[model samples]
Target: MCMPMTGARRSTSFLLALTTAAGASLLTGCGVLPGITGGSREPLTVMTWAPDGTQATNMPGMPATAVAFSRWVNDNGGIDGHRLKVLTCNEQNTNIGAGNCARRAVKEGAVAVVGSYSQFGSAFMPPLEAAGIPFIGGYGISGEEFTSTDSYPVNGGQAALLAGNGRQLARDCERVALVRPDTIDGDDLPPLINSGLTEGSRHEVADIRAADDAGDYSSVAAQALERAGAGPGVPARIGRSAARQQARKGCVTAVLGERTETFLDSFRRVETADQKVRISSVVGSVGQALIDSTGGKEGPFEGAYVTGWYPESGDPRWDAMRRVVDKYAFGDNRIDTDDAGVQTTWIAYTVLKQAVESLDKDSVSTRELAGRLDHGQPVTTGGLTPALRWDFASMLASADFPRVVNRSVTYQVVRQGRLVAQRKGFVNVGPTLENARTSG
Candidate 1:
């Protein structure tokens, strides 16, 4: 027969069992107990860098848009239940600053850099490649953005825009004069424009180079007008008659960043009634904001032809982006609803969200994120861009820009102080870009 234990001994045994059960619960909460549930989710980290308050090409809206997007996402349950941590850097429009921003992103463990603007791609891309971080939705100012294996550009950069502009002008103008910055970066503009003009069976443009930051462009403007052989100024009715007499109407296309406005200012002052010169430009070099600031319908850009990567800012497709700016931006002046840099940032984050959701695990690293994008995932941007895919099969065949997947641009014109679509659809410049690569 077994004897019963004392009451004090029974109490001590019961207390020991309770303590062991509590220890197991604590371990599971801390992720020490694996195989039952996945580890605790880690927040996703991203970096966005742009130049603000710089003497040349300031893109303050890019980083500002990135911050606003993070807030909007976090407020609405974040991407796949993982909190987004956006670290912003001001590149200060210097090569050194761009490299430093890349180094910081690597040191802080950012999986990707999205929707940023930096002309110093050569300086920054190396650091990101070394860390295996994907660069997505960049401003596409640098040729490296199109060439880097690590870069997933959302748009076709300047190459496509310039080529498309050439095609647009070819239909209307007999002679085209391209006024571009005289810099190492601007060297690539002529060949790309020539390719498009050639495809349209038009003669090559008269390529004129000017200082990017010149205080005045009177001489350059006068020279471009003279080369185009514009006639003397006359009344509107008389000008139309004079234009018909001329064998070819002249078109002047300016691609100087920021200084395009100043160039136009000088151009208008020297313009004669008989000149009948039509001004044309790419979208980044001219926009609604510039038109409004310069004088709307009366502005020098009136009747200008422009090529852009997306639909007009007033289109209904941008309604979703405008709502985010309305709510989370809280009237922040830097975040303009129509700014291209801001639009680019919004699209970049959309890509990031889609990429993160495709992951099997809640927690991801730089390598895993980049690998997912490289594996031929198609990301849709609600009609903001063609479905973006970075696989080799989806990329353009150009040897110089093997990574460029979007070769589409829209033709637009300034009318009644608003940018309206001249054509209802996108113009394909892939053939022109391919020809450029092979001809060289």
Candidate 2:
């Protein structure tokens, strides 16, 4: 997904020192604002961090999705009659790289910037905030991060939601062993998950740890097993003998790290068919790969209860997503819309596009963009995910966008290396935004 900047785009070195203050002043002094015609060609520039980074999947789905949306925009006469040009740069999760990228976008005069697949949006928040350029695709945990007053989270706040998955499992278990990855992927998740538990409902949390630096599943599995317990045929024991029995009784469960592939690798290294332990994970951990390899027929995870953020299997939204796939995804019909990353990316981009269209073209400044976003706006993306209503105050309070887009968590049962939705369709886990705090 790493796209090289076209020859028309500026180089990063010269871009870094470019100041938006001078650019704004230059626009004002030249009378560019008042004399600008509604019909003038102004390319809407987007700076995304998908291509180069620790989390880069090169899924071909994200960039493909962007291409489809851009094609649609162009076919419909473009944004406010100006041709929309996407200037993508791979920030590679470096502050210097991201800062340089933002400067280059501003230097090239991008009205809005879009990014995701990592924390680049948060890292670049200050610059974009100062430049007054709309920064979309940021999902930060800190209220201050979301309070940028210029940026808007296209995919909603993630820090709280990521943590909420662990909190939600507390009721079902008395003890949990948290085993996360030793990379940037699992950075913000552990702190939020541990702190969100209520006093009375708190469970015995095992040591929070990262997977081995070697990315070796055996060591990770060994460490997790040692924490749980060591017994005959019981690999990476994550529960005491009593806790193990209690796990069957719904008193303890294992909460693995964030990534789907990593979790599966560890599970495979330590799991046996006879091992009867209830495991829990977040939506981002849901993927066809896991469902096929571990959660499939004769796979290790036959009865895992996976918590998903969006409804995927048999979801009505997939009908619309199919339209998007047909129109944009490319030659392969096998694109996994069910993949959590793919779904989240799809919704994130759609929300950003809708936010862009909702703003008053005359005031395309980032502050106005953020303001328009904070208030309720109509988002019609024809996406596979439910419509998003970005309640900015709620978003501001919880380090998450406080809005409910249907309270359903798609749970699937693994059968024959495939996930088959249980007899229950999409299960409504109740409104996710009830705890959202907002100060009027």
For each candidate in turn, the TM-score is 0.88, 0.69
Candidate 2, pairs of clashing residues: 174-251, 225-236, 225-237, 228-237, 228-238, 228-239, 229-237, 296-417, 297-416, 297-417
Query: What is the C-alpha lDDT profile of model 2 across 1-440, one tens digit per residue?
Result: 22334453535422532456664454345433332343344556565544433442333344455556565666566655545566666665566766777788778777666544444444566676677787654433224335465655443344434345545555554455556544453454455445433322455445445542334455555555444443333334543233333443221123332344665576666755344355555554555566575536555555544555555455676666657767765655435666554565566566666665666364355566666666756565464434545564333333343333334444444444555564344443333333433331
**Where does model 1 exceed 4 Å of error?**
1-39, 236-248, 437-440
- CA lDDT of each prediction against the hidden true structure: 0.83, 0.50
Q: Give the number of colliding residue pairs in candidate 1.
A: 5
Give a tens-digit lDDT track for model 1, residues 76-153.
667776778999999998899999999999999998999999888889999999988999999888888988889999
Best by TM-score: 1
lDDT of 1 at 143: 81
Where does the lowest 10-residue lDDT sum fall in candidate 2?
Answer: 249-258
TM-score of 2: 0.69
